[model samples]
Target: MASETIVPPTVGDQADCNEVNTCHVDEFLYDVEEVEKLAKKGKLKRQYCLDCNSRNITAYYFSNAGTIIGVEMNKECCEVQEKIINQYSMNQNRIKVIHSDVMDRSDIVASSNIIVANVLDFFVDIEKHKKIWYFFKQHIKKGSYLICNRSITDTLESIGLSEELIDWLSICKPCRQENEIFFDLEDFMDMHLYKVN
Candidate 1:
């Protein structure tokens, strides 16, 4: 969101995106109930969704007190999402579909009161994913929330995760680390919600 092209070269530009649409499932619905619970506690505001789809866009449209910025790297994804939003007439000034790498938009990330990253495993490789975590740690404002569907403890071939990042954000729900998503009743993945320290 800040001026100029200071995007990290991974999902930063079109080339790195491989011109291949990395759009995946719209599984944010699974978290909608939990998010609504959190919002009822008056915890949500200015949320950002990374590599997001339309489901969460509608889910978050209610927070008139906040803004929703959906960041996607694929042009087609953004176009499709914009069309969907327009069709729903979510024509509010608070919603934005940004066509750039989430890493490139530090200003947007920093300002967000909460972040929803469905999953980064499908979008980038392990190394790039690690870098993105580092970038998030660098920019996300303290006290903000980071809601991701992957474990921060998940590591590469012997690449240790930084204790600093772990120490910086404590999981809002310890049980989330154990909670698994069932795709056809099979364990798919774990989900986590964190509050930055």
Candidate 2:
């Protein structure tokens, strides 16, 4: 199989996708690395992406991942992801890019072993944010890993961030796995590895 260097979207590629799905190459790579470590430990069998916008991550997983599902609500992003899949001749049976809201796909969310949910704050409103988080808290099966850029805990007061959601986290009591690699993104990104209870 031909391997292309994992490159971030260029100016032209950015135009192809929605503004919400901006090309954050370094952050995307960090998300991939965090999951890759778990995959190496045999902890990841089926992986899911909440806001999958990276072609590189998709390519890497399809090479050896057990089951990879990228749930992208953005139609344009899905098209870009699908093009990469088609170009690589990846096995569609193992890897799928479902163009739909993550909340609409409960079965996928419930069955995922590792879910990489990048910042979902861009797309949904305050109410929808609460609803989606509630859906995730309820659906994501126990023992599954939830990797998100934002803190699930209420470290600060922000719109759409609900106490009920944080309450659920406290109720479930998920263990936060730490990373040795530290990022200096000015606290713009906080990587939390939650092993669901």
Candidate 3:
């Protein structure tokens, strides 16, 4: 399937993502159906989705297939989030938003099937990044996935973290595949998929 053809968002501009303090979900043009197709085809990884049998690792941490914990540093966009949560009320329990730092949420790390940490560069600092990685290493179970918008190396470098001292390789490994996984939906075009090693 062609990756670039996305349904434009009804509200706001995708280019303004960097300028805003908090980006609304509808800011970027994301075709949910296309994204699902990509996930099933093994070309991309989708969060809170269990029907993608093509995935190498089955996220076994969650009891219910639709249960997802959405962790955020701030409550800047509560209204938008509420709208998103309401959209998922039909088939399963909607997303549960945890208003706190990701590192502090040990309960979340322990139970979530796939932790989608999008735009971590905006919220996490250097020291927190190190602490969070260590925390994740200690907590997140094997076989579960971590989907992030920024590269692990880039996140470290952005925080002035020295890779020699802190070895993230021991904790998690990148999802090994023949071709790169690209999510063509909205702000997720450059996202990478990783697994707990």
Candidate 4:
């Protein structure tokens, strides 16, 4: 069988349909499908630990997938999440979802094999960065991973992250508010994070 071209949804595309805050069923499915493909292609290696089992040492996703917990609360996004879950529930039994403020959920953190935050920098405040770091340190087990992506701005200093962290975390600049390929330093700050034990 030929592999399907899975075009993951963009943040702006969802925003346009007024589905940004709602459940993004399509996007969730795309993520699930993409993850599954990666695993099948040997792009994602299986991982195991005392807390959880994950097929991939590093996973990719959006902010909504991380934050929104309940299907009912995130109607649009959950629809997609549920569809994807149901489709691969058997093969992806270990994957689970927890909904809570990233700043507050120790249980979620403790249980997570890999934690992902998309566009998280927008939500972080300089004053609260330390607290957030402390939270991650407390809950994340050694050898686990943290993957995060965020837009770059002057607030980087406020986030208390070193330049090395920024370089290691960021993956690619997808786009800008102006709907153009991100090119400038201001645009270049979009980052991705991977937690290393």
Which candidate has the top score in TM-score?
Answer: 1
Please rank every candidate by TM-score, starting with the best.
1, 2, 3, 4
* Candidates ranked by lDDT: 1, 2, 3, 4
Relative to the true structure, how large is the alpha-carbon lDDT of every model?
Answer: 0.68, 0.67, 0.60, 0.50
Q: What is the lDDT of candidate 1?
A: 0.68
Clash number for each model: 0, 0, 0, 10
Worst 10 residues of 2 by lDDT: 167-176
User: How high is the lDDT of residue 172 in model 3?
Assistant: 49
Compose the digit string of candidate 3's lDDT tens values, residues 1-197.
Answer: 34444453545865433312222233255577766666566555444233643434433333446666677766876555766555433322455667888778898798877877666555666677667777877888877777777776676676666464245433343443667553335555566666766
Against the hidden reference, what TM-scores do the models get? 0.57, 0.55, 0.51, 0.38
lDDT of 2: 0.67
Per-residue lDDT of model 2, residues 32-115, tens digit only:
887667555545433334476332343344134588999999999999999878865788898899999998899999988888
Off by over 4 Å in 2: 1-64, 154-157, 160-162, 167-189
| Candidate number with the higher TM-score (1 or 4) | 1
How many clashes in candidate 4? 10
Q: For this target, which candidate reaches the highest lDDT against the unseen true structure?
A: 1
- Candidate 4 clash pair list: 23-76, 23-77, 24-76, 24-77, 25-80, 146-195, 152-189, 152-190, 169-192, 170-192
Model 3 misplacement above 4 A = 1-64, 87-92, 160-189
